[model samples]
Target: MTHIVLVIDDDEERARTAAEQVTDLDWDTDALDVTVLHVFTDNVEGATISQFGPAREARDVLEAAGVDVTLAETSGDPADKIVTYAADEDADVICLSGRKRSPAGKAVFGSVSQSVMLNSDRPVLFCPPE
Candidate 1:
C-alpha cells in the first residue's frame, strides 16, 4: 500500500521547507507518497492575512520542489479542520510545524499541535519552527 503523508501547516515558508525535506527524503528512499496539504484557518483573528502569506509561499516552494500538493483554505477552528482532514484522507502520517507557546499561554489558550497529537489516530510528526 502507498503511504500518504499529510502536511498541516499555516506558515508558507515553513510548510514548504518541510515539504521539500520530506520530498528529498522520500526520493532517497522511494518508500512513500508525499502530499502537502496547506490548510489556512480563518477562525483566528488576523490569521487569514498574516498566516495566509506564509501558507501560500510554502505551497509555491513545495510545488517548485516537485512535490505533489493540495492547497485548502478553511474558516473554522484550525485543529478541528486538521483532524477532520487527516481522518478523511486516511493519512498514514501527519506532519505539522509546531510553535512554542509560553507556559501561561499554553495553559490558558492551549496549542493546536497538542490538539492534533491528542486527537489524530494516525502518526504525527511535529517540526519545530526555526
Candidate 2:
C-alpha cells in the first residue's frame, strides 16, 4: 500500500528540510507519495514560481528519495487549507518545519504550525528548523 505524506511550508529551505526529515524517519515500508502544499492567503495573482520555491525544493528532495511527489498551490488560510488537503488526500501524515515562537508571538501573529497541529486529524510531524 502507498502512504501519502503531506509536507507544508512557505519557505523553500524549510520545506525541503521537512520532506528530508520525513524520508529519513522511515515511518513505513510501503511506497511513499508526497504532496508539498503552499497556501497563498492573499495577492494570489502576484504569486509567482519564486514564492513557491520551497515546494519545488521539497519536490526535489522527495523525488530523489524515490517517493512520488505532487506539488499543489491554493489560496486560503494556511492552517485550514493544510488540514483540508490532508483529508482530501487521505494523507497518512502531515509534516512541517516548526518555528520556536514566544507566547506573545504566537498570540499576536498566530502560528500556522500550531493551528495545523490542533486541527489535523492525521498525525502531524513538527520538524524544528535546523
Candidate 3:
C-alpha cells in the first residue's frame, strides 16, 4: 500500500526543508506520496497575505524536489486545521516541526505539536527545527 505522508507546518522554509529531508531519505516516491499542508490562522481581515507566501514557497520546494505533493491553504486555528486535514486525508503518517515555546507562551497558548500528538490516530513525526 502507498504511504501518504502529511507534513503540517506553519513556517514555509521549515516545511519545505522537512519535505525535502523526507525525500532525501530515499523513500520511494511511487510508494510514498508527500503532501505539504501549511496551516494559517487568519481570524482578522487581510491576514491571509502573511500566511500565503510561506505556503506557496513550501509548495514550490516540494515540487522542485520532484516529490508528488498537494498544497492546501486553509484559514482557521492552526492546530484544529492540522488535525482536521490529517483525519480527512486519512494520512498514513503526519510530519510536523516541533517548536520550543516559552513557559508563559505555553501557558497562554497551547502547542500545536502537543495537540496533534494527542489527537492524531496515525503516526506523528515531530522534526525539531535545525
Best-fitting candidate, measured by lDDT? 2
Q: Which ten residues in a row have the lowest lDDT in candidate 1?
A: 26-35
Tell me the TM-score of each prediction against the true structure: 0.71, 0.86, 0.77
Worst 10 residues of 3 by lDDT: 42-51
Model 3 alpha-carbon miss at residue 45, Å: 5.9
Query: Across residues 1-130, which tens digit of lDDT does each residue of candidate 3 receive?
Result: 3444445555666766666566666666667666667655644545453356555665566667666766665667777787788788888878877667898897788888888888878788777766
Pull out the clashing pairs in model 1.
12-54, 12-55, 12-58
Q: Backbone clashes per model, in order? A: 3, 1, 0
Model 3 segments beyond 4 Å from truth? 1-10, 43-51
Candidate 3, position 82, lDDT: 78
lDDT of each: 0.64, 0.76, 0.68
Which has the better TM-score: candidate 1, or candidate 2? 2
The top-ranked prediction according to TM-score is 2
lDDT of 1 by residue, 1-130 (tens): 3344545565555766666555555452334545555455445564543256655665566566655555555546777887887778778777777777898998899888889899989888777666
Please tell me which model should have the higher TM-score, number 1 or number 3: 3
Off by over 4 Å in 2: 27-30, 44-51
